[model samples]
Target: MTGLGTLDAWVGRTIGVGWLPTRRDLDAYQLRCLNETIGKARVESPFYRSLAGWPETSHLDELKDIDRFPLTTADDLARGDPSLIALPLRDAVRLVTIPTSGTSGRQKRLFFTEADIEATVAYFEHGMATLVRPGSCVAIAFPAERPDSVGDLLMRGLDRMGAIPVALPVDGPVEALVAALRELQPAAIAGMPVTLGAAARCMAADGGPPLRIETALVSADSVSPSFRTALAVIWGTEVFEHWGMTETGYGGALGCDAHDGLHVRETDLHIEIVDADTGRVLPDGSEGEIVITTLRRRGLPLLRYRTGDSGSIAESPCRCGSVLRRLRLAGRIGEPVALGDGKRLRPEVIDDAIFAVTGVIDFLVEFRSGRHMVVGLVTSDPRTVDEVRSVLRSHPAIGPALRAAGIDIAVEIAVDPPPPPCRKRRVLGVEHVA
Candidate 1:
């Protein structure tokens, strides 16, 4: 068996097997569950039943046959139609309302049963075990005020592993979180990328004893290369990236020790990469939009749900030798702002360069009419402000994108504390004004 706490055994246990499952066993189990989920959705979900062009009760002969079903989008859920629920509203223990700008202010409400929530907790327990030792303290920096929130579920999982789980306010002041972590001296920390990076920079400036943090689980947003390097270099901790959304019950793929890619929670989700323009499924190692299908979810089973995130299935086998497939995320899709010269500016490109500068905490990018851009930066040290402006001006990606688009950029720096982390970070593009 492979070391480094690979999820192979946990997967076997999830699929009700005593040992690790071979490729054939995993596929067979997925096919069976897929058929069951389809059958259940057909009967219990009004959305599935009313959806056109799909067989009412037909069982998928193979996993590839899923292409026959039509795709589900955020708009479908954003409609707030009760037909999306696979079970009665009363049965749902937790209801998550996600307000999306793309939805014209209509919120996407998700229903989760007690069983569904517990499944996520199970994934968290086994997944987090790889990062933290038993009896170690874990500072959960995500939201945990409500029951069954990602943080609460994480806390429950860490508790199961005999690890002490401490909740740090994700929306509160970064200084407070840094102080709490310093006092707690946690073994592992889990939260969003920007939040963790901001706090790490603050800790580095404090100039105290090195934090004993062993691992960091950064999730709820894309993890930048610079952010990972910052955490590793500053705290001497392994940074693990996690990819998931409320649609996937908040637990999807997670990075193993190899750090090459994230090992997916295949027991619950069957992820596929598909072309954004056409709904065609792409081959392995091909970057495209992420599509998800729930395997065991009962309250609200999703079928071919388009996540609008760009990623690919890793072509190379994991060094950890886990039987599960790995997902290599390429961040969110459609994030590029078109410039006047038909060139495009990628927020991630700017993010990577901005965060590479030391003492930089968090930054916001505002693009106007493809002609001008304002980079609002919050830095721990005022001295780093000049360094950031120089870096952005000289960055290869930023310069070309700006010149080709004929866009002028102004760097604005502030030493004041940054606001709480937003739901998702991206370029704030304004309409091109005449």
Candidate 2:
């Protein structure tokens, strides 16, 4: 049995070598993982046994003949009792829980054991090794909800690596955060793209402290390239992006130094890109839903869980020497707005349009009906509404698609306002019908 230190050492070595495993190695590892996971599910989880319809199977190869076990939805977890836990309550060493994004109706609860926490820490440490050097000072800009939240995990990892951790909690007024940044003066920063962008704009206008940030890591939401460029200009640093979800224990993939695409943690988990409607696996470089199977979780494990995000896998290895398979997340599958003419438009299209407008701070897109959509934008200047409308009308995707769909675009612009603090904020869509 590998302990936490052993796991950390393995992650460090694997990441140093670019975190890529050969296809043969991947296949063998997957077989072993499938066997262990299937055996555990059949013996411990009555829900899984009923769902899989084969409680007596001794090996996963038998279940592989059936379509990969159906994805475990947030709804399923929320509707079930806590007795669904596969392990004894007394044996669980650690508990890390987070509220879902609530983009869906209700938020689901997630539980992580000590081993699960160790695995998550190992994955993050490995991912950060690609961008962050040891002993670098890291300033985090995220919600400060609990002592054992993701922010705490990041701080602990940085501490273990001998780096200074500066936490700038974003649950308060923007002015207070600006004051803290002036005091900390950390080397690196991490936060949601929207919050970080807003902070950058504030510094640019208020003439605050000189932000000598070397790298800015953005996650917890989809970020547009234009937004990345804007933040880079504000902070005078390169912006890095990461993708993950709560069900995967807040672990997903990381972008390479090239900044072209994200490399999946194939050794830690198996990724399957499947068609959203058909649930059939798609070829590489084709967009579909991202489904993940955890290979290394001991407590509160998930098998073939649907992430509700849309992305494609890159066929070739990155030039950065990482052997892990790369994935390009287009946007969330649930963020698409359905039109009256049976067509759907992704939020990325709208995001790209809004971000193209100069001086735009933060924005939200609301889908009121099949024919009406509103864009609420925060900006420093008052002329932002017209600028936003022009950009939206000029976009090849949003403008032409909306015109063809016979829907009108409405733009609402306002000065910067503080956003409510929450674990997950949906800046893209509010009240999506489809």
Leading candidate by TM-score: 1
Alpha-carbon local distance difference test for all models = 0.83, 0.68
lDDT of 1 by residue, 8-90 (tens): 78888778778887777789889999999999998889898888888654689999988888899998998856478887789
Tell me the number of clashing residue pairs for each predicted model.
Answer: 0, 1
**Which 10-residue window of candidate 2 scores lowest in summed lDDT?**
1-10
Candidate 1 vs. truth: CA RMSD?
Answer: 2.4
* Per-prediction TM-score: 0.94, 0.85
| C-alpha lDDT of candidate 1 relative to the true structure | 0.83
Model 2 stretches astray by more than 4 angstroms = 1-9, 12-23, 53-68, 81-83, 93-106, 367-373, 403-416, 420-433
Itemize residue pairs with steric clashes in candidate 2.
Answer: 20-323
Query: How does candidate 1 fare on TM-score?
Result: 0.94
Please, what are the lDDT tens digits per residue for candidate 2 over residues 159-205? 77667878895877666777788788877887877677767766766
Give per-residue lDDT, candidate 1, residue 164.
93
